[model samples]
Structures are given as structure tokens and as C-alpha cells.
Target: MKEICIVEFPSNLGLKEPQPGKEPGVKKLPDWLWKHNLHKAISHNILRLDPPKYSNSKDVETQILNANSLVEYAREQAYLINNLLTQNKFPFILGGDCSILLGTAIALKQKGNYGLFYLDGHTDFMNISLSETGGVGGMAASIVTGNGHEKLTNILNLSPYIKEENLWCVGNREYDDEYENEIRNSSATYLSLHELRKQGISNSVKSFLQEVETKNLDGFWLHIDVDVLNDSIMPCVDSRTPDGLTYNEFNELTSYLFQGNKLSGLEITILDPDLDTTGEYTKNFVTNLTSTFNTFKNTIN
Candidate 1:
């Protein structure tokens, strides 16, 4: 067992608010407000990394022209993370969005092959050609898998930062049929909520573990997005889905993953406090998450 540490990231995609839908429309907030308020609101349990603001923060352009700026940003964060990983600390990150996974994942690639226990509602495998929507969040996973956007793919000087064969997506329930098929074809594995409900968390955990052990993976990483939880439990996500994992179910899964002790890193993404109503979502989010880390800490210590 290893110690778990949190690394904070500050990034607000400066877009506009999305239209109401489960396939989330993009929403933009003032970057400064997001950094000062929303980013500040995340828990302080883990090591906090300083947020990066580029010279172009004030300039206006698509995330494309600014891709170089992002690459620079990724490099800096990657350096900090690689240094820490060498010290044998488990790196957990609070994200601007799931895209932050690219930088952190890149930093750990040198550790040899690792598995991804990806939890998300959307497949995020679309490229410029496949994406019906132009939102970067929708394409972030594909980007990390070396599917789209050179600026993103080139960041931290790595391509296909995560191996698709070792990546498994769990709890994703909402998706277009075409995209669902795409996930089936991709190197990744998809375990939906229906499967989870039918098979039970322990059974699902056992299934994932059996595959990993049989394949002989070097390590595993857990990437969690709040959207994986039901809209009833986590409504502050970028997009809210009506049906998903319950709190007890998600916590049970979390405890099992922690207890497994094969985790190389943990990354929590897609928390939007602005989208939250009474902060109940944020409270539960942090409380459930921190309690998880605490339990892991106690066991390891």
C-alpha cells in the first residue's frame, strides 16, 4: 500500500453556458471567478499544485491557436508530477475537466504499462470528424488516447499517453448508439450501470480484477468524473444524467478499488460548483471523496 496525495489544478474553459441537455452544451464562465471561487472551493486534503495561467489568458483565440500555450502548461505540470511520482507518492488530481488527465497520465507513462479504471457517462472518443458537438471535453479521452487534436496529442511530448487495451470505462449509461459501438470497437472496455446493477459491485470488481490479473498489468489508475453518479446524487457535473450509480454503490466500488492496492494514481474531474444549487452536491462530492481517501490512508498507515 502507498500514500495517496491530491494535486489541485485550475482551469476554466472560458466558453459560454451550455444549453439544457444530457449531452451537455458548453458553458463559459469568467476564468478569474472560476479560479478564485470554484477552484478554491475544492478540498485541501492533498498536495495542491499551483494553477497555470498563460500569457494568452487575456488574448482571444480558439484552443487551437493556443495549443502551444497548453503544451507549455502541460510540460510544467508533468515535470512537477513526474518528480513526485519518482518519490513513490500516489498522485490524485482535481481537474478543470477530465482533460487534465492527459498531463498527469503523460507524467506517469514512464512508470511502465498501467491500467485505467475510467468512470464517465460519455465515451469522449470523438475527433473533429466524428464529434457532432465542438466541445473539447467531449473529445478529451480520444485526445489522451492519441485520437484527435495535435496540440493536445503533442502536449508533454507524448502520444497515446494511455494505452487503450488497459483502459476500462465503468458506469457510463447515456450515449448515442454509434458512439456506443465505437466504444465496443476501441481498445477500451465498457461496463455500464445496467451491468453493475445486475451483476453487483463486488462481482463487477472481481470481474475487472480478474481481467487485470490475467493480463498481468503493472499498475492501475482510477479516473472518476462526478457525472458517473446519478443526477439525483451529483447534479453539479458538466452534464447531469437521471440514472447512474448510487452513493452507496459508488462508495462500495471506491473502497474496493482502494483496497485492491493496485492503484498508481487517482484523478477526479468534471466538478462544476456553478451548476450546483445549494452546494449539497459539492458537499457530498468532497465528503464522499475525502472519506474514501481517509479510509485508504488508515488502511495503508
Candidate 2:
């Protein structure tokens, strides 16, 4: 439906800097995606941004690693996205982690309130105290919805980057006792993996879209954490959960989403190329992604 431009962020501050001697594969995603000719296969025009400087420092108060750097980086990212949208181009953001969703949401919030379609293995709704690692990635969804540290929630003095009713979280398979309570109390609509299977993927998505339509919002952002795929096929994530969608299922869901013109942009996150030693996963990912985009193009025409 719209011309696509790939945006790459090679920083991993959101997930915390890679431990010494261990590579943070998420930071290398841009290179891996480009190596596999993702740009060539998906779109003719590609835009690459310089990666933000890596920082391992943490805020003593919030226990969020690289909090300062993350704020600055998200601000810069929002600027870039705003510029792209002003040009009337759809951005396909290749992220370092789900924290990039903060930048995208800020950009959209500047224009108006918009919806979010989050597809991830984990709900990412943990608060600072409950989060095991205190990484922003784990708390990104909560932070964007104005539930976390003030520094993140009040970015640019705009809190609650997205409205609760406009947010739809899907494919989340991991949740603990506290998180379950959080979800129950949260205003955001959540579709767990179990419910998604029971209701059927197509029906689940259609139902979400129906709610989105009723909201009468500007548009929505699509976020995909690769861990949403089956662990057997995609084990490259930092945390792996059991029972995810098959490649065919992912493609079908993506194609259905793309068929709609309401999507303002899309972001793909949590893909660690370092784990794919054989490159089979990357190959399969590229194939599915390309096919999905092509399906969208066909629908638009």
C-alpha cells in the first residue's frame, strides 16, 4: 500500500549492553538483514541511520541500564521517523529491541494518539521492581503506557505515548503471577497465545482490527518480536518460550495485517543473528518477510 523504507538501529542499550566476551547479537541485526539482501528484496529505497553509542551505565534510582542514552537515542529516532512520515513514506524499523517502540510511539504521539499492535512472546509489561534484569526491553510496553520510571514515561513531557484502549497485545506466551495480575488490571487489551489458538489467528486479528476501527484513531504501529515464532524454528532470542506460530502461520497473519491500509509503520525486534550459525533461520525469515510484503503490495494494487 505504501513505499517502504528500512530503518536500522544497531544499539542494544534497551536490553543492556552485551556482557563482556558475549556478543549482543541483536545489535548485529542490521548487517545480517542487509547481508541477506533484505533491502533489495523488500524495497528499492533504503535508509540507514548511524547506530547510537553503546553504554553500560545504569540509573541508580530506576536500575535501568543506559537510561540517559536510551532517552537521547529514542528522541533522535523519533525525529527520524517524523521526518520520514512527513515525506509520506512508511518506515519499516529494524530494531535493537522493543525499546525502539518508545521512539516510534513518541513520533506518532506528536501527530496524534495512535494504536499499537504488539506481537511478542512475552508481554513485556514488567515494572522496574518486578523485572529480573531491570532492562528497558522488559518494561517497554509498560513504560510507553505511562506505568514505569518517570524518565521514560515522560519523554518530551508527553506521558502515556499510547492509549490503553488503542493498544492490542497479541501472541504473548510468557507471564508470571505478578504479570498476570498486571495484565488483568491494565487497560490494554491482551490476547494470550492460548486464547489466540483457541480463537484462531485470523479471527483473533480480525477481532483486534474491529476494535481498532471503532477507535477511529489516526493509524497504528505493528511490532513483531521474532520470539513469537515457534521455539523449534526460532531459538535465536535472548529468552525462548515454547509453542509459537509456524512460519506459515506467521506469514498468514502478517499478510492479513498488511492487507489493511491502517498500518502507519512496522517494527521487527528481538532477532539475534548470532544464534543462527547455520543461517537457515535468516534464510527462512527473509523468505517469509518478503512474501508478506509482496502480499501487501498486491493488495494495495
Candidate 3:
């Protein structure tokens, strides 16, 4: 365990729609959560980052768009994460959206060779032609691995930031048919939601860990997309679904990462405050996550 640095992704990329618009999965935080007092309650040590407002300045409605300044902005975040980790701090990135992961992942790689475990319901493997919907965020994974647009992959001088062979998608429940064939043909490995529910998250992570240990990776980055949790319990996420991990199931999976010291940094995204009914969803999520990291806070201190 190490000190946790929390970063905030202030950019919305025009994803905050009133009713499932381009900001398809974006939600505004309740005024209460944004209150300074609310920030004090979380248990884990955190560092907050705010990217800036008005990120999607070129065209909010463009189907295939990449943030013009994402690369520079990502580098800023990378710089902070690197400096903190050098000081023995565990940096946790809280997203304006999952797009922030591109920056976070790149920053962690600068540290050394590390296995990338991208936990999301969608493969995020879609490109412009392949994406059912042409949202740039949908192409995040592809963008980072050099599979999508060059402008994005080349952002922050992070071309091929993550080698596809080393990237593993965990709990991909909303698989598009096109992505399925691609996954089968690709070098990346997958542990489906069905497989996880059957074998348990611990078992799945163990398998992945064994592979990493055998290969002698530098460390590992753990990225958690809120969509991985079932919408029944976590309704505030951008992409809500009926079938996903329960809160307890998610807690179990995450606790193991902390206990083993496998997770170096984290990024949580797609939480919009505008859509919340009572602010219960995001509050509960942050609460549970803090509890898991606090169990061994003494080790870090």
C-alpha cells in the first residue's frame, strides 16, 4: 500500500446530456458531493486533478471527435502521477469520463513495464466504422493501443501506449459482435462476466497475476469503469446495465488488489450527478471504495 493521489477529470467532452445525448454517460455530481466537507470524508489518501472546462471546443456534435488538447492535458496528469509515485504515492484518477484513462495509463507506463488490466463492460475496442455509436470515448481502448485514429493514439507522444498483447479486458459484459471476432483474433486475453460470476473475481485475477509474474512485468495498473457494476446498485454511471457485478462482488474483487499490492494507480469514470435520484449511487460507491483501501492504510503510513 502507498499514499493515494486523487485526480479529477474536469473535462466533460459534451457528454453531459440532459437525456442521453452526446454526454450519453456523463452525470453531474450532487452539489453535496462537490462540497469541500464531502471531500474530507473519504478514507483513502487521495489527490484531486481538474483538467479544465470547455474541452470539446471544436464541435460538440461531431460523431468522430478527439479532444484537441487531450494529449497536452494528459501529459499534465502524467507528470503529476509520475512525481507522486516517485515519492511513494499511489495515484488514483477520478474521471470526468473514461477518456482520462488514456492519460493515466500512459503516465503509469513511463514508470516501467506494467500489465494493463482494463476493467469495463464494453471492450471500448470500437473504432469509427466499428462503433455502433460514433462517440469518441467509445474508441478509447482502440485509441490508446494504436488501433483507432492517429491523432488520438499519437496524443501526448504516447503512441502505442499499451501493447494490445499485454492489455486484458476484464468483465466485458456488453460485447458487440464485431468486437467478439476481433477479440478472438487478437493477442489480448479476456475474462468475461459470465466466467467471473462462475469462477469468482479472485480466481480470474489470480490467473492474470500468474501470467504477469511469470513474465516479470514491472507492476500493474487497475482501471475500474463504473459500468462494470450492475445498474441496479450503481445507477449513476454513463452506461447503465442490468447485468453486472453487485456491490459486494465488486468489493471482494477490489479488496484482493489492495491486499496483494497489485494495483499501482486507479481511474474511476462515468459518474454524472445530474441523473442521480438521491445521490445515493455515487456516495455509496466512494464510501465502499474508501473502506477497502483503508483496511491496510497503516501499511502505507
lDDT of 1 by residue, 57-143 (tens): 222333332345455656777887787678887776666666566667678676667778887876666665564434455666666
CA RMSD of all predictions: 5.1, 1.6, 3.3
Worst 10 residues of 1 by lDDT: 21-30
lDDT top scorer: 2
- The pairs that clash in candidate 1 are 15-28, 16-27, 16-28, 17-27, 17-28, 18-25, 18-26
lDDT, candidates in the order shown = 0.65, 0.82, 0.66
Error of 1 at 198 (Å): 2.7
lDDT of 2: 0.82
Winner on TM-score between 1 and 2 is 2
After TM-score superposition, what is the CA distance of residue 135 in candidate 3 from its true location, in Å?
2.9
Arrange candidates by TM-score, descending. 2, 3, 1
Error of 2 at 268 (Å): 0.7
lDDT tens readout by residue for model 2, 1-301: 4667889877677775456645467988878888888878877677666556666667887789778888898898889998888777788888778888888889989878788888898888777888766688888788888888888898999888998777778888885667766765899888888888898889988877777688788888889999999999898988888899898888988887887667788998988888887778987888888877875764531
Each candidate structure's TM-score, on Cα atoms with residue i matched to residue i, is: 0.81, 0.95, 0.85
Q: Please provide, for model 3 over 46-102, each residue's C-alpha lDDT reduced to its tens digit, 9 standing for 90 to 100.
A: 455655453323434334434555655677777887787778777666666667777
lDDT of 1: 0.65
TM-score of 3: 0.85
